[model samples]
Target: MASTLHDVARLAGVSIKTVSNVINDYPHVRPATRERVEQAIAELGYTPNLTARSLRSGRTGAIALAVPELGLSYFAELAASVIEAAEEAGVVVLVEQTGGDRDRELELLRSPRLKMTDGLIFSPLGMGQDDVDRLDVPYPLVVLGERIFDGPADHVTMRNIEAARAATEFLLRTGRRRIAIVGAHEGEVIGSAGLRLRGYREALDAAGVPFDESIIGYTTLWHRSNGARCMRELLDRGAEFDAVFGLNDTLALGAMRVLQEAGLRVPGDVAVVGFDDLDEARYSIPSLTTIDPGREWIAATAVRTLLERIEHPDAEQPARLLLADFRIAERESAGAALDSASAALESAGAILHQGAGADA
Candidate 1:
């Protein structure tokens, strides 16, 4: 049998109203009274009826998370982190994919399905800065990614430009010059690829290296295939580069595969580095050197900020922007300069730039 609120109230020697207040975490309850109620709750194993409570409070015990596509490794990993964070907060997450289409993303913002959840955490790939006005909706919302900024909601994201700069600087410090960049989106200004590209340029500027547009590989998607395709094009054009920077891990991994197939020893022939320190980065044949973009922090902070907005809908506060920290992960894929073992490979006279399948 379910323990009733009345049973808990009777055991705690408090009125039913007092028990209600305690359960809701309402202010003004005395400390001793709260303690007594808590003890009674523990003994009676009383769990508040979330359905009834939500009906009265006009809130659902769930939040919605919308991302471009979970098929992409980064989004899939991010969604998992977000789900874990929501579970810790005693809330459920409803996930939706927008396929990275502009119209679909905009339609999601206006969808009635949002009413089923308390708030939304949205990551838009196709939307731009001009679409910020459309975020002025009725429900609480927190925006993720570099798509739109200075909007009417809390924004949580990583410092793409700064992190990318750090990644470039790391490669430069390892004595790798004439570095190539893969996964650049043409004409992207406020998007992740654009910002990361800017960072890479800044790093080169600071290092006194010339910004050669010829070494930039453009792609519409940051997928593995796109990375491989862009790298292949760069090679076909006879572009000379000592290292490569993949904007994301998938792209980096993809580029690495092509480089290996073309008889280039990773890090030995052309050092390779990528962003997003994904779980797979450590297990690649040669391992992958990448960036840790504070993914866990992004997930937890998004949930916390959304809940705050949901709790105080009438509070007049400007949108909040939170940036996640990033770090470089040193691994073998960046080449012999990154680790002594890779240097040993270099000493073995293994031709780094042979062709794929040489030693893969």
Candidate 2:
């Protein structure tokens, strides 16, 4: 038979209530008493009956995580990080994929399945800012991604505009004046692609580089094939771009392969940079230069925030918009190129501002 709370309490020379207090991390417990309880728990291999605890606490002891396709490296890696964080919190995670379909994302928000879990950590790709009202559900919710903001829940996302600007500036700094962008969704106002594109334009304006529409590669998806296809399209149009910025690492890698196949040497004839510092970025042919968007922090913070909401449903805290910090990962892709890449980026900022003025 599995060890019981009585066994643990007896071994620790503490009452059962003391063991329960330690397990629940209840404040006011003496440090020495908590330590003894933990020691007894480890020695006896005591595991709490989560199902019973949930019955008493009126909580599920589990959380739901809904995202787009997990096949995408970014989402897959994020889900793994979330799972690890949930486990550390002594909670289970129920994962669901929405295929980035707008209807499905909306359905998930109102689904009865949400009641089975204590809270939800949602990353909606298809849903836009207009769908913010759907987030007004009964259960606790924590939103992730650039699609929706100012919703009825806490939000966690990367600094999309700033990070994209940094990536574009990195390419420009390498002496690449004519930079191309891939994996952009044209006329996108609230999505990740749109925001990142805006950031790219901002960086170029600040650097004094003229923003050329011909150099902007548009795509609906941020897939590898989309990257390659966009690069081919740019080449076919005879766009004079000496560098490429893929909004995501996958797109950058795809674009890099196509560029190489077209006889363009990476960082030699053309330099490439990507966002989202994925594991594959480090192993790419020339090693990709990308942005680290605080993935670990995002995952842990999302779980922590959700749990707090779940514990205190009546808490009057307003929805939060948390932005993750970003850093450029210098590698062979852009690092080995012109030593003046940083200076070039500084000049491109002026160019970006000029473009904005023309638009205004």
TM-score for each model: 0.82, 0.83
C-alpha root-mean-square deviation, each candidate? 8.1, 6.1
Error of 1 at 15 (Å): 13
lDDT of 2 by residue, 1-360 (tens): 788889999999999999999998899899999999999999989998867777887998899999898999999999999999999999999999999999999999889988779999999999888888999988899999988888888998888888888778767766789989999898897878988999999999999999999999999888999999999999998998888889899999999999999999997888888989999999999999888887888998899889999989998988887776667777778765466545455344323211111100
Misplaced by over 4 Å in model 1 are 1-49, 338-360
* Cα lDDT computed for each candidate against the true fold: 0.88, 0.87
Q: What does candidate 2 score in Cα RMSD to the true structure?
A: 6.1
Report how far off residue 334 is in candidate 2 (Å): 1.1
Q: Mind sharing the TM-score for model 1?
A: 0.82
Tens-place lDDT digits, model 1, residues 31-51: 999999999999999998877
Model 1 per-residue lDDT at 214: 99
The C-alpha stretches of model 2 lying farther than 4 A from their native spots are 1-49, 340-360
